[model samples]
Target: MDYLRSTFVILTVIMTILTLLPFWRNQAWWVRVWDFPRLQMATLSLLFFLTEMALMPFGGPAAQIVIVLSMACAIYHALWILPYTRLYPKQVRASRLNNLPTLKIVTANVLMTNQQSDKLLALVEQHQPDILVTLETDLWWQAQLNVLENDYQHTLKCPQDNLYGMHVYSRLPMQDPLIQCVVAEGIPSMHFRVTLDSGDEVVLHCLHPMPPSPTEDDESTNRDGELVAVGHTAARASFPTVVTGDLNDVAWSRTTRLFMKISGLLDPRRGRGMFNTFHATFPFLRWPLDHVFHSKDFTLRDLQRLPEIGSDHFPILVELALNPRVGKGQRGLEIEPGDQFEAREKMNNAGVKSRHVHTAEN
Candidate 1:
């Protein structure tokens, strides 16, 4: 009984320590990785603390302190994610205009190894989204999705086998189309202007930054740096904008929040749900790596996590309506002098030097 109690107490302390480490703002892959599973951590901490309290009421002062500290850590982690749940008010208001120009987009990261092009095709056919963005596509996936050309008139395709390929297909016409490598080589992000039926043009930025893991890069510097670059681009835009893709980071992460603030975009998931979209095969270990964010000129119409299509990531579909009065008086994250200095430092660390390849429409 003593050994079991000691083990539980040790594990509780370890989890509490891990939860607190992310507050250091360290860019190391291991530390940033902790930002991905706040919900899971909170749940586990709650369960362990409750079990310890119920099973070992007389387990000494150290055990009691550990249990209490673990409980507090659980609440702390939960507070960071609470805004993403229905418990908090939505950051973007719902659209009430019946004739508003609405755009529906589906963003999915088809595992480069997942040969389920047919499933993705069926999903596109079913949803009939105005725009579709796919990540981790290779030459084979590009060929398989080429059939979509019949419906989508404008396209920006960068097919690479290096696990960073991206393709964007749109029914609406695109202007000033560009494909640029934001962070590391072989990874590309798309930026263009898509015109709606109402003649309004919205700037769209698509991204799929590399994730931090043992097999991949050693640090999250590149991912965080790339997001900061894109956020700055979005912030400078004079028109309505939409940014979507598999960010490879969770909504509550510090980097993600900073990106949102710097870009002046709003997340539809706020005050709605977590909409976990990754690790589709493992129900116990899922987080939202897929995202769709838009400027204040837009309001929420609908957002959903689509059914799995044999890939590790569940696709995310977001519908947004354009409203001229949307962002008035809404507070946005201001870029402080320190933030500007940090952004420059991150950009330098990222080593992004590629020029955007501009393609004239056919």
Candidate 2:
């Protein structure tokens, strides 16, 4: 019993640290990464708290206090998670009429080493999406996607082996397609205008920012900088805009939330579900790293996570109807006084000196 109590107390202390670390909102990898596993933390914290209480009903005051701390940790994470659940109101309204022109996008981070091209190809064929964006695709993967050219004639390809390669194949007519290296020279993002059948044009920005990991950058600064940079750029777009890709940050993270408010885009996942797409091999350790965020001019037609394609990340498809005529679905994000200032600061801090220009080969 003593051993078990000690174990529970130690777990409680660990959970408490995880809970408090995110509050710092530090761009350091260890601190920011904790934001990605709030769901797991909430569940584990609550479980440990209850199990400890049930097992040690007559524990000393110190043990009881530690148990209570675990419960508090659970509540803190729950508050952040609540907005993404159905219990909270959805940020984007659902599509009521099918007649509106719809733009369906499928975004996936295909592990560069995974050779299951057929799996992704099958999914693209099944969905018949208007635009398909794949990340971490190498020259070999690009060849595998060649079959899509006959269908998705409007193409933008920036193939590299640095695990940041991006390819966008669109059935709709695309104009002025340019691939910009947002932060690093090899890390590219696609910017283009796709004309819909309704004669309306919507700007599409596809990005796969490098994540904050030991193998990758040790800090989240680069990811946060690229995101807010795009956020500011998208904010200036006059046409209806959509940004979809593997953001490498969760929906609830400080940077992501700041990007939302700065860009004034709506997340379809809010009130729908988490639609967690990463760690496809590990069912218990997944989060929504792949995302689809759009301007209020669009409404959710359908958003879903497709089957695994042998990559660490699953594909996410979101069909949004073009209907600014219907009025903004939700109130625009109230850009706090510090939001824009902090956005600029993030870009400055990351030392984003790139011209963000595209090569001649679009």
Give me the candidate number with maximum lDDT: 2
Worst 10 residues of 2 by lDDT: 353-362
Cα displacement (angstroms), candidate 2, residue 35, comes to: 1.0
Off by over 4 Å in 2: 353-362
Off by over 4 Å in 1: 329-338, 352-362
**How many Å off is the CA of 76 in candidate 2?**
0.7
Worst 10 residues of 1 by lDDT: 353-362
Per-residue alpha-carbon lDDT of candidate 2 for residues 129-176, written as tens digits (9 for 90 to 100): 999999999999999999999999989998899999999999999888
User: Clashing residue pairs, candidate 2?
Assistant: none
Judge candidate 2 against the unseen true structure and give its global Cα lDDT, from 0 to 1: 0.87
- Per-model lDDT: 0.85, 0.87
